[model samples]
Target: MENERNEDPTDWDQIGFIISSKYRTAVLEQLVDGPSIPSSIASRTSLPITHVSRALRSLRERSLVELLVSKEKRKGRIYGVTEEGKRLWERIEAEGMVD
Candidate 1:
């Protein structure tokens, strides 16, 4: 079901899917300022760490976010919006999709 949705590749559908989740939208909003690890995003968004992690995974699957750094260890993984993500985010903001 999720794989089917990911295969669509339509910008509107992608944007709609992203904005549909508050957690995902919050994470993207936070990333707009700069790259951040999950903890930082969780703190800023006031969402739990686990929720943040899940949101990151979903965003990554959609190619709207990328992991900037990943060590052999579990910590210090950084994430930022991709170029396509930046453009879509701008549209999301410009069109006032978020409250």
Candidate 2:
């Protein structure tokens, strides 16, 4: 659903969906800075690899993040934020949702 209209970061539903989960917020926050592998994300976010992987999966399903490498390669798969993700992040920042 990458083409879906999530242009409004001010959308309360979308904002609530994101801030409701710390893992999702942290994962998205990390990716917004740049692309990185899951392990690196886990390390930087200080979260477990399992949590990072789950967050990535959820974010991918929402079109907020995407797989940047060959999915079949398995290990060291890279992920980056979508334009929509950046928009959401901007709103989250503006609202001071996270520390």
Candidate 3:
């Protein structure tokens, strides 16, 4: 998660990327089941709202996850894993990396 944008986008390991942050991993895992509001994800993952927001922003940046609500909405904005996120998550889960 440290200056990873500089790496070749194709060369970057998506699985490794999510695995590097518990926040990111937890958010992804929660979304894997289905899209949910940030509050639900934070509550289920036992992570702070701040952390979840950061993770969401990062994942969205890579097109791994997406906002399911209007961008103008300040609250109740749901988030869901993208197909790309599902693929990376499946690879991570297959390796028993999910908590």
Give the lowest summed-lDDT range of ten residues in model 1.
1-10
lDDT preference between candidates 2 and 3, better one: 3
Residues 1-99, candidate 2, lDDT per residue (tens digit)? 664465554566667877888999999999999999999999998999999999899889888899999989899899999998888889889989978
lDDT of 1 by residue, 1-99 (tens): 775576546878879988999999999989888999999999988999999999999999989999997645479999999988888899888879999
Top candidate when judged by TM-score against the true structure: 1
TM-score for all models, in order of appearance: 0.86, 0.86, 0.85
lDDT of 3 by residue, 37-87 (tens): 999998998999999999999999989999999999998999999998998
Candidate 1 ranges with C-alpha deviation above 4 Å: 1-9, 71-73
- Candidate 3 is scored at a TM of 0.85
Candidate 2: residue pairs that collide? none
